[model samples]
Target chain A: MRDVYVIGAGTTRFGELWERSFRDIGIEAGIKAINDSGITGNDIDALYIGNMSAGAFINQEHVGALIADYVGLAGSLHIPATRVEAAGASGALAFKEAYLSISSGMYDIVVVGGAEKMTDIGDEMANYITSMAIDQEWETVFGATYASLQAMMARAHMERYGTTREQLGMVSVINHRHGALNPDAQFQREIKLETVLKSGYVAEPLRVFDMAPLSDGAAALVLASGDVARKYTDRPVKVKAIGQASDTISLHDRREICTMDSTVYAAKRAYDMAGMGPEDIDVAEVYDSSTIAEIMAIEDLGFFPKGEGGKAVEDEKIALGGEIPINTSGGLKARGHPVGATGVAQIVEIVKQLRGDADRRQVKDAKIGLAHAVGGSGATAVVSILEAEI
Target chain B: MNMPRFWREKQGRYNLVGNRCTNCGTYYFPKRDICPKCHRKSIGKMEEVRFKGTGKVVSWTIVHDAHPDYKDMRPYIMAIIELEEGPRLTGQIVDCSLDEIHTGMRVRDTFRKLSEDGKDGVIFYGYKFRPVKE
Candidate 1:
């Protein structure tokens, strides 16, 4: 296989963007990435679009063609536009497909992106769309919302690991602090641990502050073979490893609620493929759909021992200027999780950090970075490791 | 309205038993036609097993917001109770305040009607748990 590198990355400010249509948001990010890569539309060999719920959210489908056509890539005869849907990991799965296409010499350059138009729908509708990842047969029938599922995991973790409400609160605070520095983050203001703790309960143990808001946004990346990458940019973030895993879809089916075995499996595979462990990375972006999810990812990624993830946050081990700064982009918690876009957005953050362009949230001399994206109640997981050099 | 095939099974007195392949030992709740572990379609019969519904609270959250059908059910405690059978089940925790529910607290199952198939239809009865009496 040939080496694959990220030549350019772009993402819109994540939030309830009511004015931006899904096509516009996707095209905006796509155009920005193409421009940043200093490549014309003609240089792109194929396109992959990750969208979770356009059909359910906007009553629209064929989003890959919509995005490509909106960007004027389809005017001229073009390659097929592959639409990837793996719940929230939809974006990462798209990126993985594009990355492999280039690495396998099937394509010299590929455009991989994800977009979600969430705010147009009411919160109720949005929640339903997001709930599509859960087991329709067993879990959803019982009125199990994603928040409820996370709540279940949170309670389990609390019991097994002694993860406290305060520690979970710390995750929101730390991410918001970093998000305060992120211009494109949905939430730009810093939140105190106290505020998170005092927030009204959305689910027991988890407050309103614990969950990510309904967001509408898009993120795009340009991937090219190592040879093509050198021509497009001076600093290309190497795609060292990518791994995806799945557990039982129904939360009830899983043997353990607190243990995200899929994420742990994916992370271990990524680390093994990269020939390094989580400690070898200078920075990380974990799926912080909720403060609890971030803590779970931190532990699953091996940044901390099992059950100590919450303690890692409480001890300031995951904060900026700490032992390992996690989610410098504010993460999904503070950054706003536009479901489909979150995974690609995480990659954009990692690429920016590896390229030393993150400005305020930049991890110093960050040579390697990791991104983990989880789909629906820890059912599907994807882990990618990026390095500065081959 | 007719229940979904999965929910239809719950109406039986089987207690919604899950089957485990004795050979590979991969377990499936609500039972499975084939073993996920060994891929043997000739799976063992699902044994009628009942959980004390008594299990430790693995995790829980009180949902202040709920789907419209459950607007009345807002602020209800939805929790996962890890059964001794090794499957973690999702259910509402009744008969307890939000503060009273904690991870690792023992819970007992109460078979209850979770929702109506609508007003004039089948009442969907499922298992929810309450804090086990000390």
Candidate 2:
């Protein structure tokens, strides 16, 4: 296999986009990415879309075909289009497919997009739909909601490792601090640890402030084979490696719930492929669907030892200028997690940081970055590593 | 879920029946066909093994937010119970207050109403946990 390069990226403002239609925002982002890459629609060989549940959100299926049709790449243009789904990790998986196609010489240029319009439905139905990511027959059937699942993880992590509520709250506080600088972030304001602690309990050990809000947004990336990347853009972010893994979808099925095995395995694979270690990553965007998740991810990804993530947070080691700055994009918490779109948006943020375009949240002299996306309660995880010129 | 799907899994739900790989002796709940570790060798060797309906709470949470359907059950305790048979489960811990729960607390299964689709829909019944008699 050969190398793949991300030539351009485009993303929409994330929040409850009640006025924007899913297809319209998707097409808008696609057009932006295409324009950024200096590539016409005719130059695209294939289209891959990462979407979690358009059927539940917008009552639309065949999202890939819908996008292809709306973007005017159908009929005579007639490009092959496919949709990839893996709950929250949908975007990264879709990006992986696009990268593999280019690396394998299957397609030279491809447009990979991740979009979700979750605000169309009410909060009650939206919360229920997100719970579908876990085992319905076993977990959800017994009142194991998505928040409840993470809550259990928090309880266990606290019990076994002494991870405090204050420690978990630091994740929200720090991310919100970064989110304040993010132009497209939803909750673009700083929050205090007290704000997280005083918030109502969605589940014990997890307050409302600890969770990422439901959002509607889209993100698109234009990828080209290494051979022709320079023809499109000078600031090409090389796709150094992509790693993905899946474990038992149900939290109880796994022997442990405090740490996600999927992230550990996926990070390992990516690190191996990239020929680097955690110390080498200058910047990272981790799966922070909730506060505890960010804590657990940093540990499981080998950034810090297991059970020490709490200390890391308390020590302010994860800040922008601190060691291995995480979630400079505001994370899913403040950036607004539009689920499937989160993974792709993470890559977009990394590209900006590497290309020296991330204005306020830029990590100085950054050359390598990592994006970690998780599906459900630690079921699926995809870790992608990207690099720029040293 | 639809009626047929719930009906098919009713046996395991009610009895807390887990399947073990005869080849490797690994147990799984909501019983699956293949053994992840043993792979092809354990395909036909999987057998149902009924749990004693008793376990210790490995972790727990008091749910304050739930869908409208589970409104009455809001603020209830949900826990991860590790059974003697080795497969863990997620369920509500009943007949106990939030302060009464902790890790390693002994509990036993009780058959109860899980949920209903809607006012006109099917009612699903399954095993939930209650504090075990010392």
Candidate 3:
């Protein structure tokens, strides 16, 4: 297989973008990435769109064609657009498809777009739709909300490992600290530990602040074979390795309740393929749909031991200036989780860091970066390692 | 869920019926055609078994914010229960207050209304856990 590189990355500011339509943000991000790569629409070989529950969220389907047509690639250009869905991991999975297609010589260049408009619906409806990612028959039918599932994991982790309320709250605090510097972050102000701790409970032991908001946004990436990438951008980021894994959809089915086995397996494959361990990573972006989720991710990614994630957060080990500097874009917690767009947006943050474009949240002199995305509790995980051309 | 879908799962929903792999001796809730551990070896070796519905809470949450369909049931306790038969599943723990519920608390499944299609629609009944006082 040939090498694949992310030539350009672009994203819409994540938040409750009530004024923007779904197609509008999609085309905006896609066109920005295309323009950044110095590539014309004719250079794109195919389009891949990542979305979760657009049919349920907006009562719209056929998203791949929808965005491709609006971007003017489906009609005259006649682009073959395929929509990919994997709950929250949709974007990274779509990126994996594009990466593999280019590496396998099936396509020389591909544009991957991830978009979700969640604010169009009410919070209760959105919660129900997001819960569809879990086992509907056994879990949701019995009245389990999305936060409740994560709350169970948090409860288990606390009982098993002594993870404290303060530690979990710190994850939100640190991410919000980073988000304060991120212009695109939904919550641009830092929050105190008590603010997270005392917020009204959504699920016991997990307050409203613990959960990521239902956000609306889009992110796009331009991927090209290594041979062709240099012609477009001099600072292309190499797709060093990509790993994806799946676990049982139900939380109870997992062997370890606190750990996301999918992340453990996926991160292993990514480190092996990249020939770089967690210590080699200069910066990283991980799914923090909840503060507990971030704590579990860092441990599962091998940045810390299994039970020490809470400690890692409390000690400021995940802060922008701290060791490894997790979630420089504020993560889903503060960055806003527009599920479909989150995975790609993580990569966009890394692209900026590697290219010295991130103004306030840049991980200084960063080279290698890792992005982790999780879907349906811990069922689906995709880990990708990117490296600067330098 | 639609009528036919709920209708098809009546046995499991009502009786805590699950399938067991004869080869691995592992049981699956919500039923499974293939045993992941045994893979091809356990194919066609699966048998339906009924659980005693007695288990301890592995992990749990008290939900203050509920889904639209479950607004009437706010501040409810949901848990991951590890059945005596060895498989775990999600269920609601009723007939108890939040402070009384603890991890590893012994419980038994009780038949109750899981949900409904509407006020006058199909009232779906399923197994929910209640604390075993003894």
Candidate 4:
């Protein structure tokens, strides 16, 4: 296969988008990406839309076709719309597939994005939609939701690795600080660690602050073959590698809970394919579905030693200018995880950092970036390694 | 659908019966088709082993919001309790206040209904724990 590069990326502000429909929101971002890439709608060979629970949230399915139709690319060309679904990793997986198809020379250019209009359904209905990620047969079958699942995982991590509640709070405080600087972040206010610690519980170990808010947004990325990347933009973030893996659907079926094996396996593969290690990565965008998930990703991705991830945050090791900057884009904690849009949003942040477009959140002299997205209870994981140059 | 039968199958077993991989010594809760640790198909029949239920709270959160089906039970404590045997389990914290929970606090096992799928569906019951009183 040939190489693929990201030439343009765009995302709308993430928050409670009360007015925009899913199609309109998606079209806006897609058009922005197309404009940024200097490519018209005709230049796109295929479209990949990552969406989760459009049926549940909006009472609409066939989102891929809906996006294609709304964007005015349906009839003239066989713009086959492929809808990707892997819980929260839907967008990242969509990007991954589009990148592969382009790299393989099947498509010259691919427009990839995700959209979610969760706020329309109300929080209660939205919560049910998000709960689809868990084991419906056993876990959710028993009425346990993702909050309860993460709470259990948090409890287990603390017990097994001596992970402190304070450490978990550190993730929230740091992300909120970064979120304060993020113009598009939903929760753009810096919060104190004490505040998080004292926050009301959402689950035993996960506080309200520890969780990402219910968000509605859309994000888009334009991918082209390496040969055609220069025709689109002067600066192309090369897609070095894309790695994805899945653990058992049932949390109880997994071999270990404390360690997210899916993340470790996927990250390892991505790093190996990119011919780099954690030390070579200058910036990272990890899935912080909850604060504890972010902490676990830090260790699982090999940024820090086992059991030292929480402490690393306390030492300011994950700050914007620290040893390894993580989630400079405010992360899911503050960035607002819009489920379907979150993974694509992650890629957008990394692309911005690599293009030197991120003003305050920029990591100095950043060369390589990695984005990690995980599904429920660590059952599914996708790791993408991107570089400034091939 | 019967509460007693479901409880008997889970809590009545006494032991937190799970699958243990003889090849790699990794234990799996709720059993597994194959040993994930060793990737070996030849796995011994792991038996029911009662945990001290006494483990440390790995992490926890108090859920203020609840699903529509569970709205009445909002603001409940859910936790991941790491058993001394090295497996972590998710359960509700009973007989303790939200303030009583802390990371690494010692806990002992109890069984309770996590949730019911529907009125006619199963009333799921499983092991949970509370802080072990000194």
Best model per lDDT: 3
Model 2: clashing residue pairs?
Answer: none
- Per-residue lDDT for B1-134 in model 1, tens only? 24666456773322746666666555455566776666655455444444545687766777876765566767787776677666666777888987797778898778776766556877767777788788
- lDDT values, one for every candidate: 0.84, 0.92, 0.93, 0.82
Cα DockQ of the candidate 2 complex: 0.85
lDDT of 2 by residue, A319-380 (tens): 99998899999999999999878889999999999999999899999999999999999899
TM-score of 3: 0.99
Model 1 chain A scores worst on lDDT over the 10 consecutive residues at A135-144
State which candidate has the highest TM-score: 3
lDDT of 1: 0.84
Q: Write the per-residue lDDT of candidate 3 for residues A273-329, one digit (tens) a residue.
A: 999999999999999988899999999999999999999998999999899899999
Model 2, residue A255: displacement in angstroms? 2.8
Model 2 lDDT vs. the true structure?
0.92
Give the winner by DockQ: 3 or 4. Answer: 3
Q: Order the candidate numbers by TM-score, best to worst.
A: 3, 2, 1, 4
A125 in model 2: Cα distance from truth in Å? 0.6
Candidate 3 Cα deviation (angstroms), residue A214: 0.7
Q: Distance (Å) between predicted and true CA of B23, model 2?
A: 1.7
Interface RMSD of each: 2.2, 0.9, 0.7, 3.7
Cα lDDT for residue B66, candidate 4 = 68
TM-score of each: 0.92, 0.98, 0.99, 0.85
lDDT for residue A144 in candidate 4, whole number 0-100: 68
Candidate 2 chain B: worst 10 consecutive residues by lDDT? B65-74
The residue pairs in collision within model 1 are A155-B58, A155-B59, A155-B60, A156-B58, A156-B59, A203-B62, A204-B61, A204-B62
